[model samples]
Target: MAASLKMSDDKQETEIEEGANTSTNASPRPSCLTPDRQALADSIMESVKASVSKLRRGDPPTIYIVPQIIRRVKEVAYEPRMVSIGPYHNGKERLQGMEENKLLYLHSFLSRNPDHRLVDYLEAIEELKDKARSCYSEKVGPLMGNEFVKMMVLDACFIVEILLRFYPRCRKMKLVKQQREELEQNEEDLGLISAMKKFLFHSNGFEDPILSTIGMVYLLGCDMLLLENQIPFFLLQHIFKMACPVKVPHLLEKMALDFFESRSMPWNEKIEMNDSYYHLLHLFHSHLLLTPTNSKEEPNLSCIPKFKLKPNLSCIPKIKPVLNKLKNLLPCSNKAPLLNTKRRRMIPHATDLQLAGFKFKKNEKSNNILNVKFSHGVLEITPFLIGDNSETLFRNLIAFEQCRLKAKFHVFTTYLVFMDCLVNTSKDVALLHHNGIIDNLPGSDDDVTHLFNRLCIGIFHNFKGSYLSDVKDNVQKHCENKWNKWRASLKRDYFTNPWSFISLMAASILLLLTITQTFFTVFPYYRPRSQFLIIMF
Candidate 1:
């Protein structure tokens, strides 16, 4: 009976152990925790759920702070200097001075149209507040309801006032000599001329702070074009239309173009205005891609005449083909590959391309600065002006292109990369400058070279099927031509100067005379006197 009791006890212990093992293998149960820990976990879950609910569904963020990697290179280039337009740099002590100016602009905007009260503008911005908030990449917290609405109203009014003040000035400055004369003579332009004169005379004094000093105006313009310092275009348009007595379609864009226009870096006036621009910077970026009226016409390669050797060099024609054939037989390791690949193909630098008989020309035929074309041994690039503001303008444009989600073309980025490939050193800059392709107004060739080289740092783009790929490939193929290189070598080495040409000619004449004299001298010795005389006769 004691043995049976011991066996039953062992069986019960095994069953208890098996039940524990089965429980462990099943899904885990919630652990008993302290009240504080449980509260913390519940708070985190609630916060996550709230954040998930607040997430934007289909609306993509347009305005963004410049990426840290890109901004770290030139931090000041991305930051607003004179004024802050959007909430990104709002209320900073350095930029606070401009806030009073914004209010002053608001007062002036209200003064333009007394019929529309301040409440009307406030209500308008209130309606756009949610849409405007969605435009920014980050939630504009700390600025809610009336605060955000008030900020947008002030900023929008400030821009509209500035544009209104700058419109007449822009018209006066952009007119050519003939256009100005026509404006003076034509009855139609009388009202426009009068307005220009009035603004010009009035703006001569310091009545307005922003427009009085040219330097302040320039700095403010730069600040306005920053990627982070932007308000919505619709907001500006709404405020402008309400403030102005006359409702003119696209007058805001015209005034904006005029306000942004710089004599040092003029833009093509034939830009197409689009309603889809997120902000002023985007509008300006689009303007940089000028539409060519005659884009259907292919680049006239024959317009630039080919380099020709003097016809007097009779032996050159006969020997060139042989030299070219020999050169072709040699392998070219440095030549750019023709295959389309993900990697960006960098063409030879300006000096190197020049050495290979490639000529650089300013492409005045097209206003589109990105229209780089290579044909018939000529590489044509549109004239680009580098000024004090060039870096700020280009950097912001690049940052916008890099950051914006729907920006697939990357036109400015590709242009900069293309320029970077061409300009590796100061010598390259000098070459482009000499060719009238680059107008360096700000600094030396080294500075321009450094600007291009640095602008493309930390920027990424797949260059396989980019706009400049064909031009790049064509340039590479041109450089790889053996005949062109040989011709360039001959011209550079033998005919670089008049002295070298004279020496080559003298040597050639001496060699011919020597061979003739030797042939005549040997004929008298090898043949009989009568036979030699008969041959001479």
Candidate 2:
């Protein structure tokens, strides 16, 4: 009996083991958990609770370099080579070379502000640590706590010192002749500044010194403009104030504009610098786009002709409800629907448009690149200067608009997209080149064609809602008008010269005479066919 009981107990234990295994493997929602499983559940619950608590707070700004935006074609364009300004690119091995320069500049900046101690700068930057962190889209994991604060202070100081040295008036105040020479003695230790001095002063050593100098400056400027490589503008402002309390308003912004001002394309309207900027890149974008002080409307009287556009009302009712749902889902969305509109190429290629009796004129009235207008058979385009840094400048601007300028119409993207649509071939580029609409300082027509084509590759926007929508529709309608079509067909098909026109006229006359003869012969107003034949004989 005791042996039988032991066998039964063994069978029961094996059955319970199998049941537990089945429960664990069969479904994720188990009725019971072991000690180890319970511990894991508790840990996961805690983690989720922590994340939820963080989510209750607001998200950081969309200022980081989104991984999806970085394409393989020009991956280096979005990356910093010599220096990393902010925490996003900090501690990167490739960018470590410039850390020494940052430190040197930091030391110099602190020395200039003798009244304020280094601890004061650190304390001030530390106070803004949370605000600065909130400006980046990503969380600061590797660079947490004191490291983050130190990075901000050093980066801010470096920028202030560089700007002070770069601007004419600020440079005069910061470093006199003797002080500059003294600073230059330790040039080797100053990483980026050392290379910059060589690039600025000793470019004659290179094969193409002019091109080399331009390229170096372009690269340096591009490095600073990288999305991942930026510090907060407020930090810079705070540091600048600490350094020079008596400076005029917007001095920091002015210095930045001076540093990255495009030689080919200058700002159309004078912008009153204000503290309402995000960073240097944002400032540059605002300058180029003429972001109004108190308005969302872009003022381009030249582009705006006396033409009107009628919006498509037929589809609004159907799309409105869905769009309303999306708006609820996504607060602060643009008033316009997110569109994947394939914009109609209004004007044909330069040569084709010219052949169709449309004239190409260089529009000098407005400096805005988007200021393209068609009026009275004339297609006027503002001069677009393509130079060494145009690609870098345009790419960065487009990327910034993509990441930060939420819901706002992408004017720059739309303009580039329009240009890309117009220039589909080398012939189109050549026509624009001939008309002086495109000043190709970079290279050949093919190069310019490829550049424009590549620019709008991944760009998407609400083309219908853009400011140029009316202009595009007008140009398309003008191109497709019956009168214009007839004129173009006549000129292209029949009017090669006086000879062709004469030949066509002669052919027409001969055909008319033949038809008349046939008509008279076939239905003769005579006695009969036999009588007619006899009379003819």
Candidate 3:
């Protein structure tokens, strides 16, 4: 009876084990998590879903933080030194000093038309707050609702006031004078009109903190041009229209350009205001492209007059041979063939190209500084000024091209890359300076060289599709021709200086005399004395 009972218990245990194995095989194992951990996972997933939905509902961001690859090369260039316009650099301690100036300008703007209250501007900004927020790439969580609206109103007012004050300076003729007189008559007691008068007429005793110092004005201009330091153009326009009693279309754009213009940076006044601009920088860039020489399409080399070598044969006797050789070796007269097989990222530097029989000429006809042309053996480029703030300007322009997604051409970036290729050392910069193609305003040749070299350090360019592709390929083609190379070698080796040319001439005479003497001696040896004399006679 005991043996039978033990066997029964073993059979029951085996049956239970078999049932558990069957259940395990039928389904997957449950998650090994406690209740709290499961709840945390669910919450994390829900947050991710909510963020994705929010992003989907948002408009495409027009303003962006400069990419790390580009910003890391020159962080200071993208950072605002004097003032911050947008939310990207709004509340920094270093830039807080300009916040008071912003408030003062805001007060001046409000004082322009007493009929338009501050609440009116606030309401306008309030209505567009969400739209404005969507223009920024990152979430402006730190500045919410009222705070954001205030920033927009204050910044827009400050910009409008500055432009108003600068308009007289831009146009100082009868029309501007009449407008000023009318404004003074209309609102002589207003702070905005008084400030404009002080800015225009009282240059010697100008008391405004921001506009008093020249360095401050210059720094403020640089800060305003920064891509990160920009408010939406529509906000600026709306605020400008409200401040000005006179309704003028594109008046803000005109005032903004006039305010920013200087000797070193001359803007094309004949700007077409047809397209919508994103901000001040975009407006400036669009005006830059409006110059007659700058075309939206690829440049047609056939239309450009082929450069003819007009060397004075009277000055140099044997230069005709060299000129003829170069003319023969010139590439096709119609257009230089594109280098389709292999991509060329760089060309020879300026000094090297000079040695390779290439001439550099300043493109004075074109106001667009980015317009560069290559034809035959001459490279024509608009003069570029390298000043204290030039790097800042160029860096921001390049950063904008790098960050803006809808930018089709990469104009500034491509021009910088082309400049970077041409300037590798101080000698290259000096060559360009001597040719009037580069105006080194504040630094040595070495500084200009370093500036170009560093401008495109982390920047990417589509070499194959660049507008300067044909220019680059033609330049490379000119440099690679065998005859041109030989002529360049001859000129560099022998005709480099007067002494070398004289030495070459003397050596050629000596060789000719030696050959004549050898011929006479060999003729006498080959034939009898009488026969050799008869032949000579």
Model 2 CA deviation exceeding 4 Å by range: 1-59, 67-70, 140-142, 170-215, 291-348, 490-537
Candidate 2 clash pair list: none
Report the C-alpha lDDT of model 3 over 1-537, residue by residue, as the tens digit.
989986985676566555545433444335765556556655665565545545656556678888898889888888998888878898999989989988877776676666789999999989988788878877765358798988888888888777776666536354345555566455443555544344333332225787767788778888889998888898998887776655446778887887777637544566778537888988887777553343223323344344566854354344445446544543222422222223354687787688777899998877777788876688889886778989988888888878774445587787888898889899999999999999987889999989988898887777676767778777776666655665666666666677767766766675556556656755676699998878879
Tens-digit per-residue lDDT, 239-319, candidate 2? 888766243567688778887775466465577778778887887777877631111232233442444568663532444
Query: How large an RMSD does model 2 have?
Result: 17.6
TM-score of each: 0.71, 0.69, 0.74
Put down candidate 1 lDDT per residue, 1-537, tens digits, no spaces: 989996986676566555545444444446755556556655665555444444525567789989988999999898888898888888889988988888787776676555789999898888888888888887665257788888888888888888777767445355433345655567656654544444322332227988878899888899999999999899998887776543345868878888887735545668667788889988888787664222222333344446566644343344445445545543334444322122454676787678667788988876667777776777888897888988988889889999983445687788888888889899999999999999987699899988988998897776666666667666655655546566655665556578767766765675566556656766676799999989879
Ranking the candidates on TM-score from highest down gives: 3, 1, 2
lDDT of each: 0.73, 0.67, 0.73
Question: Judged by TM-score relative to the true structure, which candidate is superior, 1 or 2?
Answer: 1
5 in model 3: Cα distance from truth in Å?
Answer: 74
Clash pairs detected, candidate 1: none
